[model samples]
Target: MRYHACRIAVSLSLALPLAGCATGVKSQLEVRPWHSINEFRDQRFADVADPWEGFNLGMYRFNYYLDKYLLIPVVNGYEFVTPTFVQHRVSGIFNNLGEVRNLTNSLLQLKGGESATTLGRFLTNTIIGLGGMFDPATRFGLDRHDQDFGKTLGYWGAGSGPYLVLPFFGPSSVRDTGGLAVDTGITYGIYTALDPFADTGHSFAISAGVASLEAVDMRHQQSFRYYESGYPFEYYMVRFLYHEKREIETGKAPTAN
Candidate 1:
């Protein structure tokens, strides 16, 4: 029973980062020539390296339903009750906390400049911005530079092994999934260390509540809706785009033919 409870907790944490990096695609269905679903799927995925296509597709559909039925409704309720200023402040706090992950990964990659910038941003936001309720770092020209353990691995020549649509987490590669675990561990450690309620018996409950709020804020910041792209082969497009975007960001973009 404990094991199952732990599994549920883990799943909820992993699934909260939905659509954070996804881009919406405008449809060409009205103007494009007709083609059967099979033909379109086959043609678009012909050269893709998704060996887990069947599993990935199933998970993709599962995520769509999960977002539609569970996540979005909660997000709607959060927006309904919270004022806009409060929403932005919540988002800012989370983003400021994210700088910890970014700073760690940048240092791992030996990116001296990026590490310094990230550190500066964290200090500036936390101190001057009042617990990250505002972003003063950007105004000072210390732009937010996001980094992750996955990108650090890629920088050191680790390949993105397979295309995967993680349950609740959405699109990821094998490398990024592992990176996510490492980054999550880092964030969890910070939460534990800085927990103001640690001396109180309610630390666990407070932590859970904060985590839930962070998840909702993440979804609130995202605007992409599944299947709203209006492309018949959206799964294919998203898969391809995800791979390409990661490659470019990690400086491993494929050479032009």
Candidate 2:
């Protein structure tokens, strides 16, 4: 659970800078391609009633409270102990998870026995070799990578269905939502060997803690840019960059505006 929290914190740190850059670069780049994608999604978005959107917004508000109170403090406590190591380990865990996701998606997309073999090796190393404490794929020259079902669908020439802000989950494309389900299943299988109740509580605590830490890290990084943009823009900009970063992880070029 601590490991998971660390991963989330690290992801947010990396995400903040990338997101900041995306925002700055937004005006300089032509985003027509992505806009087209967005427009297509907007049609689907409209099919859902505004009340549902409002409900999602309300849930987001609740998440903010969780972020501020429980999650943030736990991350701060971890930071006070060993800032650098904690940060690195957190980032490494996050990257490692991404690599696993990528490997899975890549196999699903590419469909090769060799890919499955490599994925098995990765799972073995991350689970047993690392004491489940770290992911060594990057160090082993496997190259940290990730792919989601959405990217797989895109590779197969399916359009991104829609843009949706899921409550608590954040920004996601229609395809990615399905990808998340598969990923969660994989995660569940991996974690199921442990005691169920204890593992569940620990995982939840760690996730909350990591998110809080990430919010703190983002607050620090965004402080300098706060004067340049309002909170809403900053928020959306962060979401856009995180989503795009995931796309990049799946081996796609940054989406054009």
Candidate 3:
């Protein structure tokens, strides 16, 4: 039981981040073409490295149903039960906690300034923002910088390779998948370190609670809905945008508007 609980907790913690990073994506691509939503998804996109288009589109369809039936419903319930102010505080805490990750990746990229900024934001929020239950750092002119192992890989010239739609994780690339594993492992290590425990079941529960809070808060922050964008080439558009966004993120390209 102890071992199982430990495994479950770590897995959940890792899986929960999928929600936060997967959604709330804005299209960085000027969408073109008008493929049927039910168009044959067998062949991969010609330009990108998505060799598994059939599998990816199937997963995309699955994620749409999952979001509509399960994820959105749960987020709706969370919004109904929690006050807006409380929700805001929860989001702040999650963002502040993410500064730790940003800091680590920034250092790996040799971005001394970004690393310093992340540390400053973390300190300000934790101290003045009441353990990041508020975001006083932003008001103090220290906004958070998004960083990850994926961006770290890109910094060192790692190509994205191919697109993939991971089950329950939505869109990612081959390089980004590797980044996710390293990032998740580090995050799990931190959670265990901060919340040391004897009872593995209890530890799992604690991890679940934190992960759940982050997931719900992330969902509430998103304005996008699955399949709501009335674009016929939505799948291809998202694929394009994701890759474009990655390039912009790694400073290899400029932001699209």
Candidate 4:
């Protein structure tokens, strides 16, 4: 039970940043006095203890395993399989999924029959469109967008309530956290792998793969910053930057700096 809870926490933590930003941006745009959520989040920040040491330890352990097992063996295997490509195709695939998500959100906000039809089409395409391997919504000239019940509630004029950093889930506004449960429930076909354990296995693999890729990229892009501020700050910065970027993409107001 503890292990399951930890996994759930970690999964929610990673997912919240990706999905939360879009919803949060939508909420900011549709609502007023946006500081309500920010204020709540800020208050929680006071209670937030830095966990850089623990995160660093975990990263170190995970990276060692990745280097010794996954990267050394599988990455090399991929090179032999696709010698022309220097980077893994997984990144491209994930990017394509992002494009699909953006397109879906844009269409949803428009609320037009044509857009609705396209949403269905794109969903189909992503699920069965690119051999179920890639999503091409962005490539088709549609702008990316995102929405969630939290954003929907804000659009309907609900308050953002408070900000909270869940033990494993990191940063979230109280309203947004509530919406996460709804989003998870409504999102279907996301875990429909063939094997009973396939979803679990896939989730773990993707998490580890993304972490490894991030570590390598961060080593090159922000090694100095990582060394200077330590891991917790680095993690928060990453989340902040990610949310800010999503706001920019969706044409929504960002949290005040």
Ranking by TM-score: 1, 3, 2, 4
lDDT of 3 at 194: 74
- Return the candidate ranking by lDDT, descending: 1, 3, 2, 4
Greater lDDT among 1 and 3 belongs to: 1
TM-score of each: 0.83, 0.51, 0.79, 0.39
Better of 1 and 3 by TM-score: 1
lDDT per residue, candidate 2, 49-167, as tens digits? 22344554555566566556765555556567757855666554555555566677778788575466557556855776463246554456544344566777767766555555564
TM-score of 1: 0.83
On residues 1-257, what C-alpha lDDT tens digit does candidate 3 reach at each position?
A: 01123433453355445444534343554544444633545633235677898999999999899888988999999999998999888888888888888999999999998888889999999999998998888888886888899989999999887899886677799999999899989988897677755466587777778788787777677766766654445677567656666776777765358
Better of 1 and 4 by lDDT: 1
Write the residue-wise lDDT of candidate 4 on 65-140 in tens digits: 5545654455455445653432334444444444444344444456575456456545654665452244454456
Best by lDDT: 1
Which candidate number would show the highest TM-score if scored against the true structure? 1
Which runs of model 4 end up more than 4 angstroms from their true locations? 1-88, 91-110, 113-135, 188-257
Q: Model 2 residue 225 lDDT? A: 28
